[model samples]
Target: MNRRLLVAGLIGIAFAAAAYALMAPAPESTSRPNVAVAVELSPAERGSLVTRRRFAGNLEPAAEFQVAPKVGGQILEVLVDIGDSVARGDIVTRLDDAEFQQSVAQARAELAVAEARLQEAVSAANLATRRLDRIERLEARGVASASELDDASGEAQAQQATVAVTRAQRDQAEAALNSAEVRLGYTRVRADWPGEDETRLVGERMVDAGDTVAANTPLLSIVDIDQLRAVIEVPQSLYGGLAVGDPAQILPPGRPDSEALKARISRISPRFDPESRRTRVELIVDNQDRRLAAGMFVQVGLESRRVEDALIVPRAALVNRQGRQGVFTVAPDADSARFVAVEVALESDDRAALRGVESLDGPVVVLGQDQLTDGAAITRAGQAQRS
Candidate 1:
């Protein structure tokens, strides 16, 4: 009985220990660690936001004209060569006028002959008038027969008719003389342009000396480079916003360091091109220094819109949250940095203009905002402790 009691007491002690182990709680785990995100911050600024629209265009002369000859002949002399400057009424080219001069001389000689014949006709008409008067007087006095008076009258009328015919011939010769003189003047080709200075540059020379060209054949190309035109094709979406006298900036591709040329919208096409769905626009640029030339590719910037004193931030801070676009504004806490999401209104290439978040007065998260949530912890980039 003593041995059995000892064994039962040992078994009871083991069972009690197992029951206590089953009822006991496990030790609590440490709290989750705070999320660390590196961030760059920028201040919200009250500044201006200018919206610019850019387009590619080519420079062209505001006024371009082709010089052609009115009279066909062998080009005797090309007074102006390519790149030469000429003024209005300046002779640019000349044809061989020896033939034309001879024609003029022949016409003058014929005119002189016609004038002499006209004087002779006047004298014969005077004689016929005197004879007719004498015949009338004799017939009235009955000193001449009816047949004699009739013959005298017939002869006088014939002489008058001859005088009239000679007068018409003289008039015809005068017209021929004028026409010949005008033709002779056409041999001297002159440059004609409308301007106070009338000066222009010769862009091309088509014919050389001694080269034969027909009438109305192009001889040279003249352009006024003092003013230039930037021709740009704008898409239909942007065409309606353009108007005459709008300001523009023109930058030459070849000279990037040069200052942008100032221009104004001078023309806009009335119709759009169906194939391109674009409309042509012309900007008048003052090229008084003659730095810009035709056919040079250029970049044009048009001021589309502007907003002054707008709340702006860097574009890098923009983020999309729950289908809404906004920036993460830094909210300072006692020990950590909290990022609050703030929605924005307008955005440009480098900046965004804010609208809804009026309480945002601190720096915005420019970098590392993609891995953030509202009230998320962050540290300024380069300021975090090295582990």
Candidate 2:
């Protein structure tokens, strides 16, 4: 019975040991150590900040003119061709003058006939006046009857009326001749630009020798390329800041690295395009050397706004955290440099204007900012690389 009691005591000890192992708690772990992030930093600078808007545009001539014939005829000769330079009043083309010359000759012959008739009428009027005077004197002397005197007066009046009618006919003939001469002059197509010695480029030639064309048919297109217009479509958001006389920089595609041509806004469309929500703006650029040409693509940069004495940082410093746009600035700490979040005001391609953070005397994290949080530890890139 003693042996059985000892075996029961051993079993009871094993059960108590198992219960204690199941109910015991686990030990606590030590806190994670802070990690030092390597980053590039730049000091905030106080300087001027200019905001610009860029747009793609095309260069066009400031003025364009269409050369057309004023009279219908077969083209006899095309004096100017495409790419030709012409001045005001220069003859561009000529039409067949055979028909027009014939018309002019006919008009001149009619004028000559009218002049001969007028001369004949004048002679008759002079003779009738002399005869009437003689008849009146005879009647006063009682040598001629009153009937003869009346007949002489009537004849003289009739001759005078005939002279007036001939004079009217002569005037009509002269007008007809002048009109014919004017029409003949229209057969010679001439460039009629506004200013003297203003050279224009012939953009297109629509007619050739022996081609028949009607009045007002386009024969050539001329454009003044000394002054070019850079036309750009500006969105509604940026249209408000644009105004006439505002300065602009024009970069022609051909000479991208060359100095930008200085230009000014000359015109802005009063109405907006509903489909595009944009407006057209015209910038005038001087090209006296003819370096720029119409239909060339160009880039236009316009200064929209300017800020003075603003705190600026590199664009890389900006970060979006919790739906907030900000930058990480270095803050002093006893053990390491800490990152502090500062809000961004305005941003450009390479730089950003910052605001809402006091004491910008500290450095800003340019690189390695993506992994940064408020109060996170950081190390300067140079120092980290050396270590």
Candidate 3:
């Protein structure tokens, strides 16, 4: 009887629990809270975007050429050496002049002999003319024969022809003397050039004393360092923006603290190199202070045209999504970020020039854009988040 009563009581308690769960009401439905993305923001700005470009090149002498002798001979003395400063008309080298001296003396002697011969011919012509005159007078007075007069006239004419021949010889000898003297002058090779610059430095020495050289062979390399040529090649795209007389600045490679050397465009090649697609441009740099040197690598900086009233932003604020370039803009009081496509008209190292977005009056997401989507919740990095 006791076991039956306990089992009945347990069944009654289970029914009561089932009845209570069946009569309870459903709990109210709730939604999840949205989290804001922390991001660094920068204001969109309007200003002029300047386009600057830099090219690498080397410095070279503006004027350079090899100094060669005008006549061939054995070198006797090299007066100027590499790195030696020389003035206009300065003797750079000397050839063996013994042969030249002998030649000049021989020409002088030949001229003297020709002069004596010409004088003798003139004297004989005068004597013959006087004899001819006496013969003609005697013939007229019937004291001389016709044959004698004819013979006297013929002799005078012959003597005059001899004087003419000797005069020709004398002129030939005088010309030969001038030629010889000019050759003798050639023995002393001079460093000469046509310019206002009176001095230049020898850049190379090709021969030593006692070395035989032919005519027109290079003896030295003379260079003018008063000014230097800065040679840089630019791509076809940048070539159009460059022109003669444009201002430029040159900086030494690996030396940022050095002062920039002022320069201006001097020459621009009309055609681009097919192999490199680059045009050669030359700039003239004054080296009056002699602070720069040839063959040194340098960086040349130049500026192109500027875009006015364009929107600009930091490079970090711009991002590429899919195939479009754009930025994410957020209002000052807004809690979401929105993407806007922009045309990057110009870009420098740290800033970018934008186009066609006049409505960009708000700050752009700079730092946490990679984790953001269009219309995603965002908050300023330093601003407090609302609960």
Candidate 4:
């Protein structure tokens, strides 16, 4: 009876405990709130932004040509050396002219002999004409036979033919003399080309004094340095909008901080290179002060597009979310990022101009956007780091 009483009392106590546990109110605690993500932000701006494409190339002379001689001979003197400035019609090299001079003298002597023979023939022909007249008169008066008159006429005709032949020989001698003089003039090789440039630089000197060379042998390489060509290659995607007058900027080789030089597109190749598939572009850069030189590497910046008065932001701020291209913008008083769809107008390496992001009142997130969701809790990167 004592054990049953103890058991019944314990059961009653357990039932009372269960009843109290069920009746007690739940505690105020629940699930923890979402954690705030740390992100970098930048203020959206309203301005014009340009899409600039920079490429590496080299500075080449505007025009270059090999200077050569017209006749083969020994190089007597090389007047100009490499890096020498020369103008049109400047004599650059000389050849031995002793043989040429002797040839000219011989031609002149031959011409004189031919002239003397022509004069002798003319005198004889004149005498024959007078005799033929006398013979004809004698024949008419029956003082001479017709056969004798015919012989006199035949002799006069033969003398006239001799005069004609001698005159032809004189003309031939004059032509030979002219040819010899021209050849003699070739002994002095001159730098000549057609252009408006007043001067050119000697880029190379191939032959020196006492060097024998054949005709058309290269003596020097002349280059116009007053202007230079900035040659670059662009892929076909950007070649469509390019034109002849497009402006460009030339930066110094391996120097990104240096000032850029102004230039203009002078020529564009119509066809792309078959292997490279890139079109060639040539920009004319003024080197009036001779600041640039040929074969120097440089960077060329070409403006591919322009956006006027558009909303500008860092290119890093742009993101694609849920198949829509936009950026995450967080207001000053807000603790979360909001997705704002924007049309990208112009984009460069580090900046972008958007069409419809101006209405956003907060800065765009530049970093740590991949962890964000619509209305997700966020914290400034600076503030998060400080904490």
Candidate 5:
């Protein structure tokens, strides 16, 4: 009976071992279809690679000069109105010149009188000299007394002094005439800037005709709209890569396919806004057609800095894992893929410049990265060449 029982226990142990072998999980299927993914990549080229930094900014006229009155007077007429084009030295407004004209006439009359007086004094002096000469001749001949000769010389000297006084008065009248004429001229207001007749943009009129204005009081504002300046505020940290004369691209939103307007950095604010920690950069662009107006928002791009000619990929192609940015690149056979870590230099709309890895020579997986492992096999391939 003991032998039979021992044999039964042995049989049960063998059965348990058979059941464990059948229930064990099967090895992972190596035949399952590898993850299928689409990819995009960038080919290395010698073309310009710009480190485009975008900032929000407003478009403004390159220059605006206020048109103001040079003297206090009532405005007689305004030759130009808002949106009127003007050239250099073009009169914009006029003041009432009635008083100034009368002053000029009065000065001219005074000057004429002074000239007449000067001519009279000249004639009297000539006569006095001639008389004194005759008297000296007579004195030399002993026909004139010493006292008489002295009196003749004194009369000539007095006439000469009168001529000098008249000439001084004439000079003073001439100066007054010049001042009166200048004041009359001040009644006509002219454009402050010299620009082509077609390029002027005139703003609101501060004073209308018949209204009086003080000297230096703004009559109107004239802006040259032939060119526009885009003022962008850039973070101080990124200021190092930007400088005057650097090329930039301006993208006016909602126009994607339109050619980017070219611009250059014209001014860089040395000081940063304390509240925003950003520096203002001014970009000048020609708008000869006046197509760009002030206050229009523009996207400013500063170009060409670091990591040129790097292998680039669409930003969507990347995946982050454990603080490392990586993407799955397909093997040559198009049947397998391997994860690769890449160093990013710059990012644009939907693409980024990448570095690291000897050869990112083939297509990279843009989608389906989350399901991928280090050595995952891929069945689908990217027909589009890598950007």
Candidate 6:
């Protein structure tokens, strides 16, 4: 019985050894990794970039002139009121001229009387001179006394003096007449400007008809709307790219979809505001259509810069690696990817301008870079090998 038991134990030990050998872990699989990949992309096509820089500003008339009276008088009539269209030399206001006309007539009469007196004095002076000449000849011939000749000369001198006095009086009278005429002319007030017509848009009436107005009193305000100015204040820290003759755009406020008007930079304030730390720029626009007005809020756009023939890439494709900027480039075999550092220059919209690329023919990964390493095998989207 002991021998039989020994044989069974030996068989059991052999079967256990065979089972352990069969259940042992198979050799480690040496299969390749299946990494998910993003699709490769190319840079966006380049064309004319209408870049714009916007700023809030105010609208104003390019040229504004204040209408006022030149002389002081009682306003008898107001021919033109506020918002009245007037031509050059149009009668805007009138003053009381009855008293002024009477004064002119009196001056004219005084001038006529002075002229008559001057003519009579001249005739008398001529007669006295002839008498003096005859007396001088008679004294030379020893026919007249020397005392008589001296008396005739004295009479001539007196007459000459009288004539001089009358002439002076006539000159004074003429000056008075001119003064009266000028004063009378002040009664008719006309628009004084060089243009063929004065463009009256808005005005303020300070006095009514029959109201007395002082010299240089502001009767009303008139502004020309044919041309307008768009003024904008820019911060000092920003680059000043606007200068005279530069192209600009003026956009009216309260309307987002309205088309912006085109204009040109015409003036720049030499003095900068100390408190606001900004400089003012003015843009001139031809508003012959009268669509723009003064004191309206607007926005100004100045295109001061442009980048041409610049290489641009998607901003999302760039990654930061140990404080260095890098992008994932597809491998030459087209089945893997590698990280390469690049230098960026400018950023606009969602694209970036970068350098350090040998060529643009290589495909670039647009996504899936967080879990990627150098030379990692990847399966691109839509490829037959992709899961």
lDDT (CA) per prediction? 0.83, 0.85, 0.88, 0.89, 0.80, 0.76
lDDT tens digits, residues 1-387, model 6? 999999999999999999999999988889966755655544333332335678988888776556677678899887877667766666778888898899999999999999999999999999999999999999999999999999999999999999999999999999999999998887887766656445455355677887988888877666777788888887765436667998888888765534888899898887789999888888898888878878888888887455566556677778887888877777546777777788866565566666544445355566676666767776665321111
Of candidates 6 and 5, the better by TM-score: 5
Taking all chains together, each candidate's TM-score versus the true structure is: 0.72, 0.72, 0.68, 0.71, 0.76, 0.66
Candidate 2, which segments miss by more than 4 Å at Cα?
Answer: 1-47, 195-197, 254-259, 309-345, 351-387
Off by over 4 Å in 3: 1-50, 307-387
Off by over 4 Å in 6: 1-47, 194-202, 238-240, 308-387
Question: Candidate 2 has which clashing residue pairs, if any?
Answer: none
- Give lDDT tens digits, candidate 4, residues 177-271: 99999999899998897788878999989988999999898889999988999999999999889999998999986665337899999999999
Superposed Cα RMSD, model 5: 5.7
Question: TM-score of model 1 relative to the true fold?
Answer: 0.72
Q: Local error of candidate 1 at 8, Å?
A: 31
- Displacement of the residue 201 alpha carbon in candidate 1, Å: 1.5
- Between prediction 1 and prediction 6, the one with superior lDDT is 1
Query: Among these predicted structures, which one has the highest TM-score?
Result: 5
Total clashes for model 4:
0
- Worst 10 contiguous positions by lDDT, candidate 4: 378-387
Please write out the lDDT profile of model 5 over residues 42-145, one tens digit for every residue: 33323224567678889987878898877899988998888887777788898999999999999999999999999999999999999999999999999999
User: Which stretches of candidate 5 lie above 4 Å from their native place?
Assistant: 1-54, 194-199, 232-236, 239-242, 249-260, 271-281, 297-305, 320-341, 357-359, 365-387
